[model samples]
Target: MSDEARVVRIVPNGPVMVQGPVRIEMPDGTVVESDRFMCAICTCRRSKIYPLCDTSHRRRQRAKDDESSTTVTVQAPAEA
Candidate 1:
């Protein structure tokens, strides 16, 4: 380990950023490494690339609000 400090930042509703180069050991006994200046680790588990952020956690646009509007009707049971 180097004397330099490693910084980790947790982004709200997003991935966790880490200062690389880093070596990560997966649950399957496999090790993954990255030598990039920074690394984005997925927290939402929605990334197509596990342990990496592909911006898959971003909110997607749903059908137009007006077109996708839903109306619910509740009916009372008949009196005994």
Candidate 2:
């Protein structure tokens, strides 16, 4: 690895772009590592693969008059 500093970019309403290879430690004390040139870290927690961006933050398309257009809100569980 070069002595150069790694870059981290925050995308608006999206994932955080990180220059890899990187190692991440989860709340459960598990360690995750990536050797890619770049990594997309999830910020919305909507990713099926936690800590990795799967583009799940992107909004789904719906017709203006679609009955399913009704929005449902969910609250995150309170931290202990």
- Distance from true location, Cα of 4 in model 2, Å: 1.5
Error of 2 at 80 (Å): 23
List, residue by residue over 1-80, the lDDT tens digit for candidate 2: 67998899999999899987667777665566666688788899987666776677889834435423222222343456
- Model 1 clashing residue pairs (backbone): none
The true-versus-predicted C-alpha distance at residue 64 of model 2, in Å, is 26
lDDT of each: 0.68, 0.69
Per-model TM-score, in order, reads: 0.68, 0.68
Candidate 1 lDDT over 1-80, as tens digits, reads 68987899999999899987667777665566666687778899987566776677888733455322222122343346
How many clashes in each structure? Answer: 0, 0
Cα RMSDs, all models: 18.4, 10.9
Pick the lDDT winner: 2
After superposing all C-alphas onto the true structure, candidate 1 shows an RMSD in angstroms of: 18.4
